[model samples]
Structure formats: structure tokens, C-alpha cells
Target: MRITQGFTFEAAHFLPHVPETHRCRRMHGHSYRVELTLEGPVDPVTGFVVDFFDLEAAFAPLLQRLDHHCLNEVEGLENPTAELIAIWIWDRVKPAMPMLAVVKVYETAMSFAEYSGG
Candidate 1:
């Protein structure tokens, strides 16, 4: 079974590695959405893979760091593409959420990326 929780934050970033003429080269902000998916068997006792509150607690600190901040200034997010952002969140949250199976990042309503560890 898989249980997923979503979070949103607003931050600005510019893709430095993209071509100078690329539109993304200029700074812009996104109401970024990240979803954490935890995969495991549902426990007979709890009837759920994991408690939603536990997931929220594990992610709150990272949310604070990412919200209203420049993604390029975040320690591991200097390049900050949707793909890299997914990887960055997975790296920070996985230890606290061992069951985490995927980190999905939405740069826009229609564009997103997913990372499942390696």
C-alpha cells in the first residue's frame, strides 16, 4: 500500500545551468508542491501504512527552510530544477521517513518530477 501527503511552499529560483537565453535563466517564484509517498504493507493494527501526523512532523523543519526562501540559496538546491528539488527533498526526509518511496515535486500545475531514491 502507498500513503501520500502533499505540501506547498513558495520560493524563488533561477536555473543557472540553462542557456542564458532560456526563460528559466531569470529569477522567478513558484508555489511549489511536494508530495511524499510512503510504501509499505498496511499494519493490521493501525489499518494504515503510517500515521499522517508522523509524516507531517518529520517534514515540518524542511518546510520552514524551503518556504519563502531562495531555492538557489538552499544548501543542496543551487541548481533547483524540479528534478533536483525532488532529489533534495528525498535526501533530507528519507532518514526520518524510512518508508518513503517517492518524492514528487511540482514546479507548476502541469510540470513536475519524481525521485525514488536512486
Candidate 2:
């Protein structure tokens, strides 16, 4: 079974590698949406792969760091593209939740990226 939990944070960033004239080169902000997925057999006794509260607790610190901050200034997120952000989030939370299977990030309603530790 697979379970997913979602979170939201607001942050600003600029893609430094983009052309100087590109709009993305100018600092912009996003109401970023993140989803963390975990996969494993559901425990018969607990009836869950992992508790939602536990997952929330494990990821709360990450949310705190990214929320309302400038992603370009964050240590591992200088560029902070949706793709890279998904991977960065995966790296940080995977250790605490070995069942973690995917990290999905949405920069906009129609634009999102997913990472599965590959």
C-alpha cells in the first residue's frame, strides 16, 4: 500500500542559470505544494504503513525551513527548480522514513515534479 501526505509553503527563488532577460531570472515566489509518499504493507495491528501524525512530525522541520523563505538562499536549493526541490526534499526526509517512496513538488497548479530516490 502507498500513502501520501501533502504540505504547502511559500518561497521565492530565481534561476540564476536562465538568460538574464528571462522572467525567471527575476526573483519570483510560489505557493509551493509538496506531497510525500510512503510505500509498505499496511500493518495489520496499526492499520497503517505509518501514522499521518508521525509523517507530519518528521517533515515539520523541513516545512519550517522552506516556508516563507528565499529558496535561492537555502543551502541546498540555490536554483530551487521544482525538480531539484523534489529531490532535495526526498534527501532530507528519506532517512527518517525509510518507507518514503516519492517526493512531489508543484510550482504551480499545472506544473509539478516528482522524485523517487532514483
lDDT of every model, 2 decimals? 0.95, 0.95
Predicted candidate 1 versus true structure: per-residue lDDT over 33-55, tens digit per residue: 99999999999998989999999
Give the range where candidate 2 is weakest over 10 consecutive residues by summed lDDT. Answer: 72-81
Provide the global lDDT of candidate 1 against the true structure. 0.95
Candidate 2 structure quality by residue, lDDT tens digits, 1-24:
999999999999999998999999
| Pairs of residues clashing in candidate 2 | none
Candidate 2 Cα misplacement greater than 4 A, ranges:
none
Best by TM-score: 2
Instruction: Estimate candidate 1's RMSD in Å.
Output: 0.7
